[model samples]
Target: MKRSETFTTVLTEAHAGSRIDLVLSQVFPEISRNQIQNLIKAKKVLMNGKVPKPRDIVEGGEEVSLEIEIDEGVSAPEPQAIALDILYEDDDLLIVNKSAGMVVHPGAGNPNNTLMNALLYHYPPLKDLERAGIVHRLDKETSGALVIAKNEETAEALQKQFAERTVTRVYQALLVGELISGRTVDAFIGRNPYNRKKMMITEYDEELEENPGKEAITHIRVLERFREHTLVECHLETGRTHQIRVHMQHINLPIVGDPDYGSRLKIPRKFTHHAENVLRGFRRQALHAYQVGFIHPKTGEDVLATAPLPKDMTTLIDAIREDHELYVKDHF
Candidate 1:
C-alpha cells in the first residue's frame, strides 16, 4: 500500500543556521535524515516555497514543506515456518538469537527461509509493520542477538536509541592472531572502490581519492589467548557494515574464518591434528553478537539479552585451548 502525506512546519530561532536536512530531521524525528535527503532530491520538499538542496542552510521563520509516500502492508514478504532461537519477548519487541547462515530478511537471492519470514509466521502481526519489525541486522554469517520491534511506536523508539548510540551491543570473536592488549579501533569505513563486495578503512587507505565513509568505533579486549588465536569481546559504538571485521584486519588481527577480511590461512605448528583440522575447516567469520541491551520502549525498563556461543565456535575454541596447553607444557 502507498499513501502520501504532506507536512508543513515553520522553523524556530533555535533551528536557524542548520543544514536543511538536519532541520527537517529534527522537526520530524520519525523520518530519517536519509529519507529527508531523498525527499529533497525527488522535489518532494520545499523550503520557503522553493525546492531547496539538502545541504542548504536554513534561516529562522522559514516555511518547510515535506511530502512523504508511506509504503507498507502488502509489500511485506510471505510468511514461512523457519525456526528462530528467540532470547526475549514482550509486547513491544523480541530478541532473536539468529543462527549463522540464516539471512535476516528477504533480499536479492535470499527470498525465503529468512528471519523476517520466520517472524511473520511466528507472530503473524509483523506482516503489517515495516521490514517485518526488524530494527537492526546482523550479517548473514553472523550469529547473535537481534532486536525486532512489534509495532511502529516501538520501532521508532528503538531506532532513536540506536541513532543516539544508547543501545549496547557486544560481540564475541575469535581472531587469527594473539592481541597483546585491549585497544579501541577508531577509523573511517567505506566501500572499497576496488572491491565493491568488501569494506575498507577508507581514511587509512591512501589510494582512495576521497573518503566517503563514516567513523566506526570498536573497543576490543582479550577474553582468552591461545598459541595462535585470541578470543575477544567487541563493543560497538557505531553500527557500520563490516565494522568489527574491517577494524580487526586493520590491526592485523582479523577474525578467524572471515573469508573477506581474514588474512591468509596459516595453521600453527603447535596445533594437534584435531586442532589443525578445526582451524582449517571453519568457514564463516568467528563473530557472534553475544549480547544486546536497550530500554524497553513500552515498559520503560532496561532490557538485556545474551546468546550462547554456537556449537562450531565452542568446539573450535576447545580444540585451540587443548593444543595451546600442550605447546605451553613443552616450550614453557
Candidate 2:
C-alpha cells in the first residue's frame, strides 16, 4: 500500500527571502530538489495556504506545507516478464543497456511494456520505489546505458550526484554535417512556445530572477567525417530533456534520422548509393549512450560502464565509412 506524508513548517528568519524549493530542500534534506520542484509543479506544496511557484521568495514566519505520496508496494503495470540487457548489478544499484524505441517509463499514450515495467517484473522489490528506481532517463529513440538504484538512500545519493553535475555520460551520434573541431554548446532550453511537445533553444538573460528555460551544456568532438556527415562523441554537462538532440540542432548539425530536428530526407548528391540507402533506412535518431561514470552510492567508489553501439547504428556507420574510403581514394 502507498501512503501520503505531510510536512508543515514556518519559515524562519534564516530562510527568509530564499526560493521556496531551495528552502524546502534544506528543511527536508531527504527529498531531492528535483522532487521538490515536481511537487511544486503538481500543486502539492502550499505556502501560506496557497500554491506557490517554485521560485517564490518566502518571508520569515510564513507557513509552508508539503504532501508527498509514498509507495510501499508495487502497484501498477502488473509486472510481466521482459528481457533486459544487464550490464552490472550489486546490492545497491544496477546498470542496464536500454534498447532504442523502448520508453523508459510509462506516461500518456504509453501505458505499459516500458523499461520501468520490465524492471519491476525482473526485480519485484523495485515495485516499492518510484519509477522502479530509475534515477535518470534516456529518450525513447536513444539507446544507452542507464543506472537504477535499489533502495531509497541509493536513489537519493545518485540524484544528488546528478544535481551536482558529478556524473559523466558520453554519447555517440551521427550528425548531418561535418564538424571541423570539438566545441561546446552552452544554451538555455525550454518548451517550444509554438509546439508544446518539442524543445527549443531559448534566449534568456542570466540576470533575470525567473528564467523560463533550464541551462544545458553539451561538449562534442568529431570522431570521423564523411562527405555529408560526421560521427561525433558528446559529453553531457547537464541532463535536460533532449539536451543533446536540441543542442546539436541549435548549431544546425542535427543528428541523422532525427525526424523532429533533422532536415527532410535529402541525401547529398555526393553520397554513394549504398551510403544513401543506409542513411535513409535509419528511422530513429542515430544516437547511443556509450559510456557512463559515477560514484557508487554505497561503496563510495567510482563505477563506470559502457555499451557498444547497437546493430543498426553499427551497420549505418560501416556503410558511411565505406563511402568515405571510396571518396578519399578517388580524390586524394
Candidate 3:
C-alpha cells in the first residue's frame, strides 16, 4: 500500500528495553499505534534484520533499523519559480539565505508558494529521503541562514544534535530604544490564554503543545545603539516558538517592526510590509538568523554557517540609528 527507501536506523543501547511499539509511536507520531500494529502484522515493520513483534522489548545494546513506507503517495508538487539565495551546500547539507516574506514550509493559507515547494523543485529526489531533509525553519518574515539536510541519515543526526542542545543558533534584531552590552533572558514561554495564536511569558500554569512546555533561554548583546533604536545580536541556548520576539517584548524593547508583541507607540507603521504608518519604513520584522553552528552530522566535524543582513533591514537601521540616538539624548 506504500513505498519508501530501505531506511536504516540505529537504536542505541540506552533505548533498549523499550517496547517496539513505543519506538514506532515515537518515530511516527502522526500515525496511531493501531496503524503501526497493523503495519507490523503485515510484515511491514522490520528490526535490525528481522520483523519484530509489537510487544517485543528492545535490548539496550542492540541496533534497530526500520523501513517505513507510507502510502501517502507523493503528488508531484507543481514547481513555482521562486528565487532562493543558497549560501552554502555540500552533498549532505545546505545553508540557505531565506529572504523575508518566504514561508518555510507548506501550510494553510500558503501551500504552493513556500520554501518547501521550491526545494522540492530543486531537490526532487530528496523528497523521498527520510524526512525531506528540512531540519529547521525561519519565520516567514524573518530572513537569514537556515540549514537543510540532504539525506535521511544526515537529517537524523542533525535533529539529534538540535534535541541535545548541541547546535547553536544566533539571531539579529533591531529593537526600539537602547540596550545594555550583554544580557540573558530566562523565562517560561507558552501560548497566551487570551490569544492562542500568540506566545507570551507566563509565571503560573501554562498551556503546552501536546508534547511538553519548553524552557527558553536567550543571550543578547547590543551590537549598536542609535538614539531610539538598538541593533542587537541574540544567541539561543534553547529554541522555542517565537523565543526572541516574546523575550524581547518581556524586556519592553521589542523588535522595531513586530506588531504582535509590541504595544502603543512602538507598533510600527507597517510591520513594515503589512502597514506603512504603523511601524513605518521598516518593512518586515527586524530579525535575521545570522549564525548557525553545529557538528557535521556524518563527519562529526564542527561546521558554522552565517548569513548577512538583508537590505531592507540594513537601510531601515541606518535611519533608526540616527533617530534613536537623537531620541536618547533628548529623552534620556
- Backbone Cα, N, C clashes tallied per candidate: 0, 0, 22
Q: Report RMSD (Å) for each prediction in the order shown.
A: 5.2, 5.5, 6.5
By lDDT, the better pick of 1 and 3 is 1
Judged by whole-model lDDT over C-alpha atoms, candidate 1 comes out at: 0.86
Compose the digit string of candidate 1's lDDT tens values, residues 123-157.
99988886788988899999999999999889878
Model 1, C-alpha of 31: deviation from truth (Å): 14
**Candidate 3 Cα errors over 4 Å, as ranges:** 1-76, 204-212, 265-279, 324-332
Winner on TM-score between 1 and 2 is 2
**TM agreement with the true structure for every prediction:** 0.82, 0.83, 0.72
What lDDT tens digits, residue by residue, belong to model 2 across residues 1-332?
78998777666665667688866765664465567899999999999999999878877778889998967563466576879999989998999999999998776678688998889888999988866789888989999899999998898788768766789999999998889999999998766778766778878557755545666899999999888889999999988778999999999999999978887776876889998888888999999999999999888898999999999999999999998899889989
Among these predictions, the greatest lDDT belongs to 1
Q: Which stretches of candidate 1 lie above 4 Å from their native place?
A: 1-76, 204-211
Please give the ranking of all candidate structures by lDDT, highest first, separated by commas: 1, 2, 3
